[model samples]
Target chain A: MKLKSLAVICLGLLISACAASNDQAASSGSASGASAGSNSGQLSRDVTTTTSSTFAPGSQEELQASIGDRVFFETDRYDLSPEAQAMAGTWADWMKKHQNVQIEIEGHADERGTREYNLALGARRANTVKDYLTSLGVQANRVSTVSYGTERPDALGSNEEAWAKNRRSVAVVR
Target chain B: MARILKILIPLVLILSAFKPAMSQLRVSVEDGLREPLPIAFAPFVTKNGASPNMGRDLADVAIADLESSRLFRAIDPSAFIQTPAAATIAPRFPDWRQINAQALVVGTVGNEPDGRIRVEFRLWDVLGEVQLVGQAYVTQRENWRRISHLVADTVYKWLTGEKGYFDTRIVYVAESGTADRKVKRLAIMDQDGANHSYLTNGRNLVLTPRFSPSRQEITYMSYAGRRPRVRILNVDTNQDETLGPIDGMTFAPRFSPDGDKLLFSAEQRGNSDVFALDLRSRRRERLTDHPAIDTSPSFSPNQREIVFNSDRGGTPQLYVMSADGGNARRISFGGGRYATPVWSPRGDLIAFTKIEGGQFGIGVMRSDGSNEKMLSQSYFEESPTWAPNGRVIMFFRRTPTDRKGRGGRSRLFIVDVAGGEPREIVTPGDASDPAWSPLSP
Candidate 1:
């Protein structure tokens, strides 16, 4: 599969080089770019996990699919509520059941605050979840945290509902 | 020889007698005019038949720059009584004075021998019937627009006793798509909205592009790494370098006044702190180590202090500290949440965005956080950047998106810092996060 993808990339590069000399090369260039984009994602996934076909009972995929993988936060607040706390507890149990699975916690924010301020808010929120997991016996070394600030949003609307959904922390299996 | 000396001696005596009186009558606008000063602009004439019709085009650009300031009213050229040829010969003072024109601008454009363009312009005090300023510039033909701006700056400084911002450009985010899936590109254009070009393709989400003090470079936050981080781009060469391989997210990047360092925020383990990177030595220094979110830092023009926003007081408020991040004192004590504090180039005031009762507004306050005054109030507006002269501010105002985050539009707006109606700046598409550049040298 690796060889096939590499071959495809080379072919696309050759075609793009030829297309660059022509006025009608714009469409072909995007086609090659799109192929390269998906290939990179597939390559990264291949490097991370040995088994990619299905989610096992205690696997990270199952933790995300069947169990909760995210918890929402209120605007500008990093402290978890009762509902978010319960969700974090469920995630903690899953992490213990699958000791081999590592998780990265990503913090997010709504579009209200300034860019960097929201990034800090998201970082704080992600750390809150990481702290909760550690308290529940998930090893500190097993969890990593990063903040996306308000750059990525789960909801696009400007109303309260959208904002509430956008402010969240997600546990992604690594 | 005797006959010529007799005539020349009398002419010299008359001119010396009138010089002081003409100088005294030269208009010195001491304050903002209640009404824009009426001025006449005769179409620039081309010598040696350049044949590009650039003469009229260049004059129009200068006229637009003057009129946009809301300080000068360009009179209709058809109303002019002085012919273009006579304007070059002698001052038709009565003709301009009859039309109530306080000032007159006349210029000539021609092709130089070295394939360059030569532009010469003179500003006349119409009422006083004397020339105020005159200069000539030579540059490549493609730089005609810059020549026009230079001419306008000459006129502006002579009349207002203040520098003009026409020669500057703006770096901003040209946004498309909806709130949920936005495509933003770093775009730039002249102050008058000409020569619009995109620096980055919309492959990544970009925000808050800021110009370096002296170079053709910008620092902004981008998500190209799948995590938000600060990046710098050299505008001319299109080279981009990640500011830091920081362990966590970094955002809100701004160049120091000297362009030797950058200030931004970095997050780790749910704590956000302000950090400064020395561009020359490639070393990073943590400025603020508080558990609170400290970001949106701006350095004073003198570079001795910085103003930033922090939520340490349980709400986001403006704060000031030394350049190294010691001695932080809260500067905002208003009802609203203050964020995005930018120190004015003049160093007298700081502009910020305030959110109160779900309404966002732009405002200014003293450097010590006193004399707070709101400039514009609307549904959603933020990111206030000062014009080069510090006399005005430009920011973006976004209308609320629909339930699905559709139908939202963001437009740039400029308002006079001394208080005036906020006017929308026309962009080809939705725009936001405007950063005005220093006046072009």
Candidate 2:
């Protein structure tokens, strides 16, 4: 009976891995096609996602792998975007699977406003993500938030693409 | 004393000898001297047998002080023809009028039988063709420079209708070394950056040295042994004493308007809170009890209310509370975060740092956080300090390098609170975290 249960767990992992790989391949293929026409020295600048294949035997790895690295925000706002909502859904699923994991949501803003205002904006962004995860069944106690404001930048270049990348919320496992 | 007087007496003589050409000068003393007051300093006419340069030294020091305030446009000495003996010794007013001089300063320096030096001067309103004011003082020759400052202050106040900040001092962290291993020294200087003297050698990191409202003591944060604590240093005595319990990190300290208490922020465990310690009783009372960071506390001019920056709103924002930590209310509701909310000495506005769109800027608003105006925008700027008159503010700006994640340089700058062109204050090296001193006594 124990051997049968272990086989079932392994199969579940395999199926999820296949699903993630298929999604990755599909996204990368579309990204490549989109890059072809926009080669004006900006084609290579793709928002790449790197995920581990082990899958953590549950949805934890899948959720973190999908939304743990990249941040999304609404247009002309420091607030989280719908993409951020979907990302938080993954985090909630991951928290449900791995009840022991705790996470911090770090919010950031683009470099265009006053320092103090940007700090508050970043905090709002992080809290928005944290709130969404809580609503999706993730325990509020397991989620923390911090606002780096415009102090830390993921993309150092001074361009629209760089700014878009910098305006994000990242999930950091604690 | 005689040796020092020998040097000062000759300068005074030259000033009095040339006083006749400056008598008719008139100056506007009200509505803020928008333009520098044009004043003629006639060479002093020495009554006693003294060196020709006798009175010129005293006059020169006074001239330097007034001009450094950037409020006076002094007539060049070459324009003077003859010196008058006293305010009563009048002559060619046209020469001063030709130079468009609005006021004239004439004085005499003579030796007393007691071996002390006696100096006297009069401020003439040339347009009104009358002596507006006159005064006399006796002092040892070593005190001549201070006497010059006092005279300047009197003339400034008489003309501007505002208390002069010229005789004040500024205490700031003199930064050296590199970004990774920085060395900061506590340095004090005349308001115009003259007579700079290092109060503490660069043995540790020091931040925000604030002068006592009485101008006798300074309280600052120093990590002398890698432990952040506040130390009060008496300038006249050169004695330093650490404040209260030293187990936690203490920073952002400023004296109350009354100078009876010190307000500061202390980080115990992981939470930063504002606290006030009575100067005489040495008792500490926590003013903020939030789990989030609460720092940079400043007292209102009346000392009845306090404004500070806190992250209790899930982000840093300016908040005002009673002196006893009652009735806390958020004052900032706009888009961004605010830090270092320093209340102006006049009790009208609060200056702070605002971060938005990846840029740091210095901004000011009403004490209630309305009418917010950003004064300067840069890659990085923080720490807004006010001039005693509440007309100007000083802060620091850092310019990032061309490439990413590289070292940058920072410097001190000043701007009018009304949003004019920002001017950089020249220092010998990279400087940041400036705190303006109260007007000197």
Q: Judging by DockQ against the true structure, name the best candidate.
A: 1
**What are the per-model DockQ values?**
0.33, 0.07
**A-chain TM-score in candidate 1?**
0.67
| All candidates: interface RMSD | 3.6, 9.4
Question: Each model's TM-score?
Answer: 0.84, 0.64
Which ten contiguous residues of candidate 2 chain A have the minimum total lDDT?
Answer: A40-49
lDDT of each: 0.78, 0.67
Which runs in model 2 stand beyond 4 Å of their true positions? Answer: A1-174, B1-34, B41-71, B79-88, B110-117, B140-142, B333-335, B371-377, B401-409, B414-426
Model 2 root-mean-square deviation: 11.5
True contacts kept of 2: 0.09
Q: lDDT tens string, model 1, B363-401?
A: 999999899989899888899999988888999998887
Number of backbone-clashing residue pairs for each candidate, in the order shown: 2, 61
Quick one: how many clashes does candidate 2 have? Answer: 61
